[model samples]
Target: MSIKSTAARAFAAYVDRQTKRWSRRPIKSQHKVFQNLLKVAGNTAFAKAHSFNTIKTHKDFVNQVPVRDYEDLKPYIDRVVAGESDILWPGKPLYFAKTSGTTSGAKYIPLTKDSMPEHIKAARNAILSYIYETGNSNFVDGKMIFLQGSPVLEEQNGIQLGRLSGIVAHYVPDYLQRNRMPSWETNCIEDWETKVEAVIDETLPENMSVISGIPSWLQMYFERIVARTGKKVGEVFPDLSLLIYGGVNFEPYKAKFDALIGRKIDSIELFPASEGFFAYQDKQSEKGMLLLLDAGIFYEFIPADQFHEENPPRLTIGDVEIGVNYVMIISTTAGLWAYNIGDTIAFTSTKPYRVVVTGRIKHYISASGEHVIGKEVEEAMRVTVEKHGFIINEFTVAPQLETPAGELPYHEWFIEMDQRPDEQKIKEFTAALDQEMRQQNSYYDDLIKGKVLQPLKLRVLETGAFQQYMKSIGKLGGQNKLPRLSNDRKIAGFFENI
Candidate 1:
């Protein structure tokens, strides 16, 4: 009966209607999106170089443009940075989302005026879809705290540069800005410890209804708040109804978060990246997010197992099969043609296509030929948590390539513990985890049976080791996460001295 509630209901309904319409015929919608993207950027240098003008259909476009990663497209990006027009998109990008690169220093992904709206739309619709599905619009009357990166942006070649969350922060709609916290000044504090302290000061007493951020950082906030108030998160903010999270899997963090909160709150997962907003949890009953077919991006999927092939088969919405892991490829309004974002996902439903992110292409461990991915590692951790009755605050695994004197090479796990178990318990935990991983990955099982790899080594990290490492790298929060598994010990080495 309240005006605000009525307005929210209307908005949610409209978003639901639009989402249903777009998802009703996913294949056709994707085809139209692809054709439109090509038409919009047909005059750009990238399009011309890739023979976009001659492309009339999705198949034609795929055949013409070869898939490229960030490294392969660096030259064109440099040209764009040097103030070139129509180099990638129609004009220059509004900003660049600066993220860490797998093999090197940094990656600057373009965020164009044409494509930025898609990100905004997807973020808005995520909440609206939740509202529509749950009929819980009462939260609209309360505050929503979004734990994001610093709002302060740096200019590069006349375009802004910052983390994707920071760049997106600049575009927060005026209406929502009233209920969003902390203040812009507090958000600019780069140090995670200092920023979190400032956020607690600003928001501890507010009428908070929703909290949105990467789960790890959000967990940090919850821990800080609980420590200060000597109360559970639910006790501190009883009105809190929803937790929106992305950037990492929530399974490993679920139990820990629930224990901290003292009660269960509804949660929604999102699939967003610097490249584009791809999917959102549209229905409460559905485990996977509904892919945004009508977003200003065209999608292709290459089977993950074959992604390394020179000409691996690329399938579109029409041909992709459910349950098959595929590396996502995109040609977007930002003018990235057949760009591989390095994320691997599998479709859970094909009728109105939905997907769950499987893992990252580069974030895997294959030491001793036992290829272990993020999903497998997270599952192992989940089982370890359940069996040991312990909680892990953060963790990463890397290969110990050099054996100690006369031992076999094995995986080393550096874990930050929420509740440290005794030595015997830790040993039992590692054994259970190793067994679970071997059960999940046949290659790993084979390696263990053949005596080629030793049992996993566990290293307990200091309370804030992961935070300190992230802070040292200037990636303390907002979409940045420690790689779960790495082929090298670069990350493990950082924590060794700490």
Candidate 2:
């Protein structure tokens, strides 16, 4: 390793040690530490600049502060945008991580100098854990690739200085800087359309080993890599040991990825948003686990059953139970207190706190008076595909309420298959999907008996097609993801050309 890498690795080692030490604490003690961190960082009037020394206990913080969301904090963010230094976290607030949600409207989330370390630390832990699980740490000896957003910070005038991906690119270790593109830094080359093309050309180099990005974007890149290099992913990047991905679910995209690589590539999932690096997959087979970073945030959960309950209990990490679905609420060093991130999760177990992302609390379809969740749809789709002996490359389901001529309410599946199957096969597949839905949800069964629910409508796409559409639209990147369901009548219009 070069001198800078040596120094960086040393810092990494120290952080890893600290994290392992923290991870060893008894469950309650770890939760206490998490709570204390929040109390120190969450003072309402004084939270703009936190003093870590003042916070002592969870009780002190919980009682003093009420749960808050971005709507509640908008005024503070506005003041910061107006160049008020003290409204947000103290020190120079460099820029906000842009995010949008139902309640937040549009958020320009504040990021401090301190944000990168937490982000990097959680990432490193994820890497180390994957390495340990797969026994492939040595595969990282070659050029490390990151497919991220350009680091260009946005200005008020609608001109962007640099892409966020570029910002992350510039901060790469000095040793790796020589191995990367200097052209990646110049903001003058603001043409992202051309930059992406050039990056695709450069990525065809022989030495790159680890590749990371959102699944959709990475799939596009993999297509480019194969086309340019005339080699499969495994042949071109023989040293590739890990495929790190985040920002969306990987289940539907798994078959497409395996086909590109010509085999299974070890993969890890990152559950990060602009707010902070929330969690990362710690093991290969474990989808998305909560690798809790106590140093950064305090976590709370509201039971799914009690989500609409008045005065519902907001249970801390200490109070979490296995197999329960809960809405994740966070208190972060970045000054979000008991903020509902609007994501729901089901804990597989609590001994080590494994969570499967259930769905967006706000993003669901209720049709014919029965609510359908994202996870339920995903599971039903999984069953459908398995029964058909085929795999779903990508899919979205929209609920169309039909007063079935003489039957019950049903669903319409807008499926993007990796390859086409026969009409008979499609019928069998939809029947299996309906069976899975009936088994999982009693409401669907009741609706079917009442002839209020209709049978599922299957709309299949041509192979390798939707991807090309997304590419043509210039949305093949880290933050952009395929919409899972298009409920509007425009869905037909959108797919009519396909």
Candidate 3:
């Protein structure tokens, strides 16, 4: 059947669940809704589109559905391009949100009518929760700027399109649109490369209330505004109340942001993805709480403890524990069911469901081919920075692999310190970091024996260099997370450009 027919069936199924919840029935009763959708979507075709789909019941769904990584889905995406409507839910995909998957390869993630509400709600919930938690409900007092990607779709007829930033604008809920800054339609037409420059050029009143996005990108925007205006950001917009951001740990970036604004900006963390916004910081100082997207998704968590074994134990939101990082698995109205997106998150409190995204499960390197993780690097960096009594402005790590030519594999460190560190202190700190890495991972022993890589090299640049490099690449925003582990030379190239 056509893509439209399939999407209509899927959307109809999603709507049916809403209809049930509207009648005051528990939303959880819709667990069977998707299975019923599969029948209307047609058994063979639905199974074909959703890999290994021989789903018999909801239990089968919970157990039989093997996890999918973006790499595994690429061929199906290629099939969609070849005009195969079966893989894509039947209908014209309103737009494709171009996103970076696990490999840093671009994925044109579909944003159909069925999926758009989830994105809208996520952004909305993040805003509302921040306002409520901070007790700063002056949303209407001044414009709230979202340093997001351009809203313009790359094409009109074909499925290829812009990022979620664009699609979210196209499908914004009427109620939330009023508080948006820069106007969504204007954002759609603006070139991303010119967005930071344009935002800097636009003159507004001194009472801008809130600004939000990735920390590094926001730093770039603040810097540019200062450069052009001959004044600090606070001088330009003195009424700025909060600086909400996400996608990376804020501690490493706090010094620079505080320095730019001339004050400590209150921050709220967000956990957003192409498919949906999953969590956000509920309080000013606490980590993010998993605000249940009861309206859009069903969540499942795989325990980090069981994650290493061949067979892992998966838990639902109901079974979650405090302080244990788990691999998040979610089923959303958008299309995915029992999908593992590779995010590693830890709950701080179970009563309110507060959690923090600690790292990506597979987004790290190891010494003996054992997987080293993002959290490990983050903890080590946090400890080293604190111990040195110097704040880290920005940083990244890349594993330098050894070749047969008498070289050893070692980690190359790119550190942007808040101030120039003394050489002696730098040496002492590097040694401490090396020791920490060795303690955490077994590969350091091999390196010490000259069996693996060399000792990690620390390359500390001036404070603002990393920010300058990110801006040079047109990534000035709250959405651009700094790449933690640069396996290849891409980050090294970014550093070189600076």
Q: Which ranges of candidate 3 are over 4 A from the true structure?
A: 1-44, 48-59, 79-92, 101-105, 156-160, 172-179, 183-193, 203-206, 229-231, 291-293, 303-311, 387-389, 401-409, 432-456, 462-480, 486-498
lDDT per prediction? 0.88, 0.66, 0.65
Tens-digit lDDT string for candidate 3 (29-125): 3344454445533433436655435667555665656666666555655665555564545554556777755364666665666667766665655
- TM-scores for the candidates: 0.96, 0.84, 0.78
Top candidate by lDDT: 1
Of 1 and 3, the candidate ranking higher by TM-score: 1
> Model 2: per-residue lDDT, tens digit, 406-483?
654457777776567888988888888888887766777777777777667788888666666566655545366666
For model 1, the run of ten residues with the poorest summed lDDT: 473-482
Given candidate 3, what's the lDDT at residue 424?
Answer: 94
Residue-level lDDT tens digits of model 1 in 262-318 = 999999999999999999888889879989999888899999889888889988888
